[model samples]
Target: MPTRKIRRTQLLALAVAALTVPATAALAAPVPADAAAAPTAPLAAPATTASTTTAPATAVAASPTGFLNLPTSLLPTDRAPHEISFQYRNDSAGDQSIAPQVLIESPVGGPFLVPTAVSLQVETSDGSWLPLPLGIETGTLYTNLIPAKLVLHSHHTLTEHYRLTVLSPSLGTVAPRIAFYG
Candidate 1:
């Protein structure tokens, strides 16, 4: 397979390019109160008016986690495999949940012609990698939802490493996009 590994910068660029979220519905991580304090020299305190009401602090909007990480390049059909790692974090003040799925896009502008066999494995808590129960067989675009849900607590991060094997010679060289929703 004619494949090349994508650098971290390139992977991030590709992820940003491929994923699109609307402005209104986007969620941002709240800034810590201490970090929001501005540094100022000795200044006279302004007189507080009894009738004035303090405006509530506004929270800055941002994405707590980034796009799901997958290898930009897969190993050749005969090679053992390659390991890739990514971190998912919850920067929001509250817990966040997500379910992951695989999205395969047509390589050519035309319809997909062959079924791609993909094998995926996820790392376990014991520092061991285990194969996930996922199977895909199709010629057109499709999504294979992984049977797992991850809940990240505030200011916490979950690190994961995974290996992907694509059996379809035509698709082995193509990178698959991992999507997280809900």
Candidate 2:
């Protein structure tokens, strides 16, 4: 009975998470040794990182500067996160680093999202995470973007993470109302 209940709960959480996006191998199987699916866009080989995008503890992350507006309909919670890597050239001042912004959005019905915690991580080519300066909050659809002076260099991959919650009663009527870090 206990096992059955646990399975049901897992399925429920997975179902809710899947509502935001298609299931990826990491979230579907969690085989850490296996490589995740490449981006829909063309890309290079995956590099092993001392850091991962799955948790706040492992601050190692990738850049979000590619997409003009990243859709989060299937955005897995930062806790049981998904990883996507994309290459970026830091074309900011001196063509060395850039401070990027991430806008958090949810499915229609305008779910009230509060990014309790958020970060944009840039991973260097040699498998090391560049230090991210604190982000400044600008608006509701987005808040708290990486500061302007954080130095990021060429040939880097970027990842993003956010620990958030939906505040609308319509979005949180179910039992596990908040997403917890895995």
Candidate 3:
């Protein structure tokens, strides 16, 4: 019941640390075209030309919606008989981006799901849909209670989270409750 720190960057780091993405894959969000021209800017690509397979980073957001309003409860879990509810929230704002996170609780040694993938929708207030940069955070948890692979076997309660994000505030209100995997 202690208050958990909600620093999205650190929290996202924790989430990223848990994931198992191959080291060779590109993990950096694309640099904006304007920023790419500046040699002093970090992530300033040597070349702005995107590969045929990839869209330019600027193209990722069209007509550029000003910015997102922070912290919306997009998904609600049915905790049922359990006392704690699973909750999802947008943890990013302004130039900072952290994938939205879902806080989870499962009984130790019990069969449970750690989501491998999930899906969501985003739409404008006017009802037009927008493309979402979607990803499911996956990683291992390391500690005494959690083993090397992050599997649970102890008697203590486990509360952890993973990252998921919807790009636009236009995120739709109607969707099935988010589900998980083992």
Candidate 4:
């Protein structure tokens, strides 16, 4: 009976010690500062002012004068009736109009003809250029994708020279070339 009582006391003491050990350790540890503080409000951003000076031009210069001067006989003679497309970005401020021209030259003994349809568009900074018919919105950056489709008869060949002429009132003229197999 005495031994049983001693065992019970020992078990109770061990359980109590185990329970208290974690509590004591937790009490002794330091609490992090952030844990005690209340949730903070987001900081306000500073206001911005417009600049008077104009931004530098970012359009890449075209090679070989006005034409996107490509190698001689770039398109295969066998590949007749081809289409050429170009993609570019214009981030100039203020309002501007751009006229793009797609030119295709005939290969040796090949037919030379003007493109059928040419597309020039300016996208707003928000990536919505088409749905809005107002043209490029003011103060926002834009991407202009201009595609010129040319139909050349079997006798007419593709020209190695192709150029995209960007006539902007604000940025002047920017001509970028195109080089494609077909």
Candidate 5:
């Protein structure tokens, strides 16, 4: 009985998430060439020296610069969470590192989303999915920052998986975005 209830809840959540996707929705902007060269703060680095800056973390992260907004899409109306895959391609000659972010559209002023699990996997020549080594860094769709652990090789594409739920009562749409920074 407990297992059945869990499955029902997962199905309900996925159904709710999929309702937000438009029937003819199109993907967002493509990644630019210079996007791979964009510089970002180290994913795992501690402060060497203390106490010069007193600004808040949000203030410091205000509108990241030199970043490219990768393609974005909401949950498709016809597919379940597991059946859906977000793809990103690396057209450059060298490998490029990428990070994932999400944007939530809500009727309320502020909304919350819980990301249960996220994973990045690359596609093999034989059309198999292989998991990539993920980093310890964590981020949410609202934070617009997924750690840069997975790298896409030259002319290769990678797929990402996201399991998310909107904690708030108000319905909100979740769209995933990718950012390139190598």
Candidate 6:
């Protein structure tokens, strides 16, 4: 009799386990075709004009003189003695005159030769600065010629510094240091 009870209990447990699996599977089954094909509601459009109106205007600043606006790596390296020149213009709407100057220094702690043929012109007005015609040689391997001058107005005085180095056996480098005064 005990064996019969044990067998009955085993059969009941197996039946219950089988029934639970199918019930769980039914819950996980895919939705009917009618529900799967239903359309989703569209998302609301973002507000545009209000956001733009609240944003602040961007400000642009002018670049200082003598500083290379371009990356140093972008400068040419062609194994030649090069001449670097400096010029400034006063684009201010007001009538203001500025005196600009250029100076050159050698890293070797000696006076670098200036190109005798090159004529530097410095001019200033109530509005802008201009450079006179000058000659600059390009392409050669040497280090004697660099710039050393204080190009400024008669009443205004300032000093600037520059450095030169050999970029390649055939290419050279010219860097400018500039200063300004009223």
Please name the candidate that would achieve the greatest TM-score relative to the true structure.
1
lDDT of 2 by residue, 75-99 (tens): 4453433333322332222223222
lDDT of 6 by residue, 1-182 (tens): 01110011232233324333333332222222234233121111111122233334332111211221111222233434334444332222222222222222222442333334222322222222222322222221121111111222222323221222333322222333222211
- Residue lDDT tens for model 4, 107-139: 224332222222223232333322201112122
What is each predicted model's overall lDDT from 0 to 1? 0.38, 0.28, 0.25, 0.24, 0.38, 0.25
Tell me each candidate's TM-score: 0.45, 0.30, 0.20, 0.21, 0.39, 0.21
TM accuracy, model 3: 0.20
Better of 2 and 5 by TM-score: 5
lDDT by residue (65-151, candidate 3, tens digit) is 111112324333432221212332322121211122222212234333233222222333343332222332222111111011121
Judged by whole-model lDDT over C-alpha atoms, candidate 2 comes out at 0.28
Badly placed stretches (over 4 Å) of model 4 are 1-73, 80-83, 107-182
User: How close to the true structure is residue 79 of candidate 1, measured as C-alpha lDDT?
Assistant: 39
Candidate 1: minimum summed lDDT over ten consecutive residues — where? Answer: 39-48
User: lDDT tens digits, residues 1-182, model 5?
Assistant: 01110011232233334334443111212223355345353322211223476887433222222343444445332323232346565555555555554444343444333333333333333445543222121122242232222445566665555443322334444455555443
Sort by lDDT, best first: 1, 5, 2, 6, 3, 4
Best by lDDT: 1
lDDT of 2 at 45: 22
User: Candidate 5 regions off by >4 Å?
Assistant: 1-84, 108-148
Q: Per-residue lDDT for 48 in model 4?
A: 23
Residue 150 displacement (Å), model 6: 13
